[model samples]
Target: MRPDELDTALNNLAAEHRLRQRAILHSPQGPHVRIDGRDYLAFASNDYLGLANHPALKTAMQQAIDDWGVGSGASALVAGHFAIQQQAETALAAFTGCEAALLFGSGYAANLGVISSLLGRGDAVFADKLNHASLNDGCLLSRATFRRFRHNDVAHLEQLLRDTPAKTRLIAVDAVYSMDGDEAPLAALLQLAERYDAWLYLDDAHGFGVLGEGRGVLFDHALHHPRVIYMATLGKAAGVAGAFVAASHSVVNWLINSARTYIFTTAHPPAQAAAVLASLQLIKDEGWRRLQLQRHISRRHLQSGVGGCQPAFGLAVLAWRVCR
Candidate 1:
């Protein structure tokens, strides 16, 4: 597109009120933040457990920085795959009851790399209509047959699964609907996947560290299967950064060897992984945090009139539906 055409598109978007601007935050992320010099009670952060500002995580990160330096300086496949990252991966795998786990830059990267690497032309991706944008992008990028069923509509998904001729089928959905403050029927979805000989990819970013005694949606459903690939972000309830995909050892090995996003991107800082280790211990021991979150979810109507940088509804990354 030419400059003039780009300018026209921008003007059109602005006229439609589709353009969004950034808010400059001057304070740490949590319940309170300083945005545009105004102190606001922030419901926009994803720090579900208040761990982002926890002194424990801070100390662990500081100690790690002193020992490991700052940047990773290379991708994991190169020289940046630190022992701290491997430790976090192992802990996460054990926590999720998966055989192995691999770390990625974010939930988005995990979805993209895992999905695109596993499925492609001649395969099919059955996704939830309300899934995160990253999942949709991964499906499209895979050059697969993309089929979106109505949110949590099992019958529709089953029909798509039954009709697709692709031998490799993957069902992808978020464990929790971030905007709706609801959860997907993972047990039902798992049944469908098994019936159709498909795989299940669960993005549990919103559920991990916040649900099922802090074990996530899988624990909530008492669900585990070899066909399940679980991805969760540590930056939210874990209150650090990065994401990890836990699955069978063979699957993780395949991702490490084939996922371009994992291969080409710089590995997350080891210090952040240290913070994640601290956060995991904290998540396990602090049952009160999850209880407090349950209270917030139950009493959300009390915050209906509260104001902040967020609107009535939007992306899960920007606002907590639990507070809406």
Candidate 2:
């Protein structure tokens, strides 16, 4: 393509209001925020439990920095897997009721690592149409026979599963759609996974530290099947940084050994893990935050006159409203 073509595309995007821009925040993350020298009630954050700016997490992070410094200095497989990371992983697995857990630098990395590591040629991946972009990219990277069902349509997924002849099949979905504030039919999906002998991958990035009294959707539904792989992001509801994939011991072990994203990338700062450890404790012990969030969501819905009508998973009904 010519340079003028690129400029024209950029101009078109700007003219169509599709160009993205970053807001300069001058204050910490919370319900209220300061941007570009103006103050506003912010509803765009994923910090559902309002713990991102918690004093406890800040203290823990500072103490961790004092102990472990600011960087891991190496990948986890080399010299970066510090005690803090291990502790955080243990806490995360326990909190999610999974047999094992492996940490990643971010949710996008975690999704890519898990999906790519698990499925490949001769295998098939069935995903919800509205799954996070990371999930779709992971499927594409794996070179698997990628199939997408209608968003949240378990029947379509089942039909696809029945028709697929791949020896190994994996189904991936978001436990709670981040944009729409609606939940997936995890129980139905789990049943289908069991019936079709497929692996179920649940990304609970928006649900962990908020739903099921802070344990998440899988724990709430009691769907701890062996074939289930659970992934949650810490930067969002956990009120920290990084992400993790929780699953059976063997699955986690496989990811640790085979997932290139985890193997090649530098580990997250040990201090962040320390903060996450503190955040997990807060998520478990402090129920009031979740209650407060629910109240706020209810009030917002009422004020918007949207009632309780649920929208399609992962599609935001009100672009500026804080539904997730």
Model 2 lDDT, residue 98, Cα: 89
Cα RMSD for candidate 1?
Answer: 3.9
lDDT (Cα atoms) of all candidates against the true structure:
0.86, 0.86
Query: Per-residue lDDT for 70 in model 1?
Result: 97
In TM-score terms, which candidate is top? 2
Candidate 1 ranges with C-alpha deviation above 4 Å: 301-324
Query: Candidate 2 residues 227-322, lDDT tens each?
Result: 999999998878888899998999999999999999998999999999999999898888987776666666656666775564422222122224
Q: Count the backbone clashes (under 3 Å) in each candidate.
A: 0, 0
lDDT of 2 at 153: 94
lDDT of 1 by residue, 1-324 (tens): 887798899888899999778999998886668899898877577788789989999999999999999999999988999998899899989888889999999999999999999998999999999999999999999999999999889999998998999999999999887777667889899999899999999999988997778888778888778899999999888988889999999999999999999999999899998998899899999888777666655445345554332221223333343342
